[model samples]
Target chain A: MEKLTIIKVGGKIVEEADTLNQLLDNFSALPGYKLLVHGGGRSATKLAAQLGIESQMVNGRRITDAETLKVVTMVYGGLVNKNIVAGLQAKGVNAIGLTGADLNVIRSVKRPVKDVDYGFVGDVEAVNGEMLASLIHQNIVPVMAPLTHDGKGNMLNTNADTIAGETAKALAKLFDVTLVYCFEKKGVLRDADDDDSVIPVITPELFRQYVVEGVIQGGMIPKLENSFSAVEAGVSRVIITLASAINQDAGTVIKK
Target chain B: MEKLTIIKVGGKIVEEADTLNQLLDNFSALPGYKLLVHGGGRSATKLAAQLGIESQMVNGRRITDAETLKVVTMVYGGLVNKNIVAGLQAKGVNAIGLTGADLNVIRSVKRPVKDVDYGFVGDVEAVNGEMLASLIHQNIVPVMAPLTHDGKGNMLNTNADTIAGETAKALAKLFDVTLVYCFEKKGVLRDADDDDSVIPVITPELFRQYVVEGVIQGGMIPKLENSFSAVEAGVSRVIITLASAINQDAGTVIKK
Candidate 1:
């Protein structure tokens, strides 16, 4: 099979049904595409609250306390991941949802939370490209979740950006695919409020400058870092743009 | 083959490493259970806020908007689910982490959100018991996420209790094991604040009274409903208890 595009749709972009459908319609129908790695923070949090659970985070990362891990497993692996798979399937795309812990596709270590031990937070220690590629080669878009096994056989929560970055890198070695990070915002902007001010392209140096200037801090920081990592790992190109701008070539492309 | 036991562990119980290690110790020692279901709301919500994604809910149900779903897919399914699997494996339990959507084992429909559609929220409509049983029969405990696929091929947010209920019911038709709902609270309390006042037993009549008195309202409502559903479906027994009661037999038991 010809190489396909690997798109990472941030949880924010797929929050709305219409928006998700629109993005799915555009991407699933694209001439060549193979995988989608999604994040599920928003949905997980909402569901957690409904269950009267309070989430814990450390330095912008989910602490993955026991209760939080429960919600994460339920929401991300079960709810959000399947929905995306179903979305692609509804669009006539043969999508297969894969979690990092499934079949040892992705492995990691369980990190600690504060002084206490968090249940299952992973660092994406490694990726099994052979297994991942086999799935992709079977013509299934691997809709992956950022959960991994600790080699010891426990599920751990991980950064979606990190998972997507690593997966993109691994897949890039096996296929000629474009990796795009789709978010709610148009793209990397010089000014937070200006939509049209998206930096059409970013280099390693400019990307660093944006980070230092705080223009690309917080969530955008990991996104840019992941994009850069993918680009560095030989992904043909990586674009970060709003889900709405999915149809248009309007986003920041991080090039090595 | 004997029917499988679908074990659900609360997030709070495994917040720290000790708790998680203890959890793994017990989980691995189980006598060939069939499946495991987990939740991680606490961690994902905290992470969602840091990402600037406001968690949204409707009627106490998580409104899976695009951004929220991303966090969910990554954290719960990927991180936490895998952690549990890894924990089990460390003790020689051959477990496979998965979301219900992995094998289309669970299916649902896109619940309409007022005039809008909840992006990925799913009301589970079916459980692929045969598929789940196949895995269980192979001596593999399927660690599942509370996610389901809309018959239309979109992944939808499903309640973990709902997943547990349906899964228990499915297994009940085939297994001799118990369906356990482990949560942070010791047991279904007559008084929510008094954990020791565990309702050791419940009948449909008692359940109705609790509902009228609001003791079984909100989160407990679903848990109770699931328990009731499982009991009614002929599950040998359905227990609602604290995660600490994994080995002990003290908990609320719902009878048909």
Candidate 2:
């Protein structure tokens, strides 16, 4: 199997002009048969504020109401995804921007109301790995937006981390997939305030110990869970690091 | 040769909910291989207004300044394009939404300053017919947004009609192509006030006679010019009609 690296970037890395340029520069450089899955949460929130729509959040996750879904669709699928694609194309990468709705790449179920009705939020159901792998085989790099569909004519807001994990797992059968989750931090830091205290690796044993120790809490928890899940599903490795240092391999590597 | 119908619908039909749903229904029913190129000018303008950016137009053509370009990217590439893709998916069309930049499907040069600087507008230079036809061959319908890219990392606002015409021309060699231009009216009206006065078949001689008769003037001239150009480029036919009536064949058909 050939090597395929799936990079999942956050809103901070892609939303600003300077960071985005740097991200594009770094991303275009480190690659062979790579795909990008991106978040546009900050941009979506900003656009929603501009459009006078209030963004609701439960815990730290956004509640994707009807209007919020439209905002995210515009920001993530349209603005951010296309910018990355054009930038990659300028660098001679044949990049295609996509939402899960396009080509039915991913079909997701709208999150059912358990305690909170996350209106238009979708929990991913399936990823069309063959269709996606075909594009990679054609040398067309897909830049995915954090959006999915219910397959019944509705767009749903989905998590970029989950999108990346699901896609990586799906494509793992045909490729030596390395899933990279990029955030603002360098890696999973031993000391949250100290960037240099990067934990080089984390296993299931370490994950539990850290969770109990209050070092692995909040948003980092779900991210780590996704990383672990991907590795278990035949993905070669899962890296957590800063978007700027993707090629450097200076990040937390998750092992089963 | 495989027959392919390329339909171009303006913002009026696609920007509204009811009209868009109707369009997806009728469009899905069109026989054989097909592609859709759409405009989102109204939606873009509305978004621009919401974002506190003013849309500038000279001679009824939008001047896509930096801010306006962002608006169009969000509206045309994101919101309208994805909506169409999702709707078609529900209708079993297996649609994939694309912009010119995607897969390098269309490449355009920025329009040089002739009289006024049309900021980021693109003049269609080439279309990758082989790449696009491959998508269609795989039974995926392409929903194209009215946007292109300069090879230099910039997304340029393009005319939907030109995209359709150019794509139709490019694909003509591999497919028997019929280019359809859908606007608000039924067709090229013989009488401006009478929607029933649609000229069923418009030959060059009749077009010249109508121009002299002052029946066809202003915007309709360029649209007809585009229709004629597509026909001459080996497209089997060009249909000018309403979006709702695409399957009914109740429109002006352009011929040599």
Write candidate 2's Cα lDDT for B1-256 as tens digits.
9999999999989888999999999999999999999999998988898889988888777999998888899999999999999999999989999999998889999999998999999999989999999999999999999999987889999988889999999999999998989877899999989989999999999999999999999989988988898889999999988898999968999989
List candidate 1 stretches off by more than 4 Å. Answer: A1-84, A91-96, A105-150, A153-256, B114-119, B151-153, B190-194, B205-222
Off by over 4 Å in 2: A212-215
Error of 2 at A149 (Å): 0.6
- The C-alpha lDDT values of all candidates are 0.73, 0.92
Native contact fraction, candidates in order:
0.49, 0.84
> Model 1 interface RMSD, in angstroms?
5.2
Candidate 1: C-alpha lDDT: 0.73
Writing each residue's lDDT as its tens digit, candidate 2 over A45-97 gives: 88999899998888667998878888998999898988888888999999999
DockQ of each: 0.22, 0.87
Prediction 2 TM-score vs. true: 0.97
Across B32-130, the per-residue lDDT of candidate 1 in tens digits comes to: 565778776765676677667888776656777766776666556655666666677667676666665665677777776677566777877778787
